[model samples]
Target: MNCEATKCQCGCDQETDQQKYEKIAEIIAKYKNQAGSLIQVLHAAQNIYGYLPLELQRFIAAGMDKPLAEVSGVITFYSFFSTQPKGKHTIRVCMGTACYVRGGKKLVDRLEDILKVQVGETTEDRKYTLDIARCIGACGLAPAMMIDDVVYKQVNPDKLETILAKY
Candidate 1:
């Protein structure tokens, strides 16, 4: 999405960088002086700006009076936190023991081929980001995959394209 172009990737009016900062600042103020509020602040920040870039992380560190290392540490420590921009839809393939044994790797390979993006990367059009999950607790549904929050059970490589089209 081009922030300077007036509309977001979804064609909605885009929020300026300054406006995003203001919102982040408000989030910081709301949680300031409260112990163990950094996670909440970071979550709000990521939601407001999509991802936590270094510059924004610095801004957050300064606003919350936290060391940059501390803020960055939290981001790195959490798998859910991303330092790069994410796609409109996130596709996570389950790679647990059951899923992997049932052809999880095939799913990953097919996605990489179709999306033209490796794991942990987003498509050029930002339509999707490919990822892997250790487990989604759907062992009974081995070879499962998830798009956004929807779980697809017993998925095979051949079914990926049709499933993705739904998004």
Candidate 2:
């Protein structure tokens, strides 16, 4: 799932906001004429643009020949779709039973305290985003968290400063 492209395959890195809108128009044009392509087109749009804001939602709805309300409904119903922007780096703290029992919740609290950003929020500097994951499939490394793509195992409050400092 890694992209080695010099341009950054996510497209969020190279494109300015305006340029992203331009590419979004092309994405819409490519799939808009087809039937039952709303979800797929939206996926591509999200990939290119990072997240779907209200205006972006309206654009996509209009492009796909869908009602704005319907598009909004679909986005809100799906956890995979974000209505806000993400940060350059994302941190996911596991909240599953295993992780929670091992101080994962404390880690979440400490993150909020340290970053002054709550779960599901991006830091003011836009360097980091905080998220809560049900599980990161690392029960063996309970109290684990993932920052960007790096997993930190057996994390504790004492290690938070050191871990975050690496970024």
Candidate 3:
């Protein structure tokens, strides 16, 4: 679906990274002037570039005739808008009260050791990024962890070895 926004008259016709920037601008132009077009443009841009870099944000703002602060605000307000590139796999360890009391901290530590990267960091191979979450709404399955979108419940330190092998 074309994003509904008004196109600005910014001169983005140039070579180099600007070309890619203009390409994203064209997609935004299609959705110009439409209500709720911000998300659509952001989604389209991210889909094309993997992540929403600051340069692309500036380009989009200029092409859409929106303020840079407005564009930045929308980007920051939405969790779906990622400013950094994401890894192929995302591992989230829940550290809620129930999970923590159930040895969730040990599980997170195990993962960090095995992955050779700390929480909130991607592996050197870019295969995985480890993150610690407050809760995943899986209290019944305390000490839960999510690999990508699949929730693994009742995780223990011993299970880490087997799980790491699979990935």
Query: lDDT per prediction?
Result: 0.92, 0.88, 0.82
> Cα lDDT of model 1 overall?
0.92
Task: State in Å the error of residue 40, model 2.
Answer: 1.2
Off by over 4 Å in 2: 1-13
Superposed model 3: Cα runs more than 4 Å off = 1-26
Candidate 3 lDDT tens digits, 80-147: 77787677899999999999999999988888899898877788888888888898999999989999
Question: Against the hidden reference, what TM-scores do the models get?
Answer: 0.85, 0.87, 0.70
Q: Which 10 residues in a row give candidate 2 its minimum summed lDDT?
A: 1-10
Q: Write the per-residue lDDT of candidate 2 for residues 137-164, one digit (tens) a residue.
A: 9999999999988998999888898988
RMSD of 2: 5.3
Residue 122 CA displacement from its true place in model 1, Å? 1.1
Using TM-score as the measure, name the better of candidate 2 and candidate 3: 2
Which tens-of-lDDT digit does each residue in 1-167 have in candidate 1? 35664335555667877788889999999998999999999999999999999999999999889999999999999988899889999999999999999999999999999999999999999999999999999999999989999999999788889988888
Candidate 2, residue 128: the lDDT equals: 87
Candidate RMSDs in Å, in order, are 2.7, 5.3, 8.6
Residue 67 CA error for candidate 3 (Å)? 3.4
Clashes of 3: 9
Ranking by lDDT: 1, 2, 3
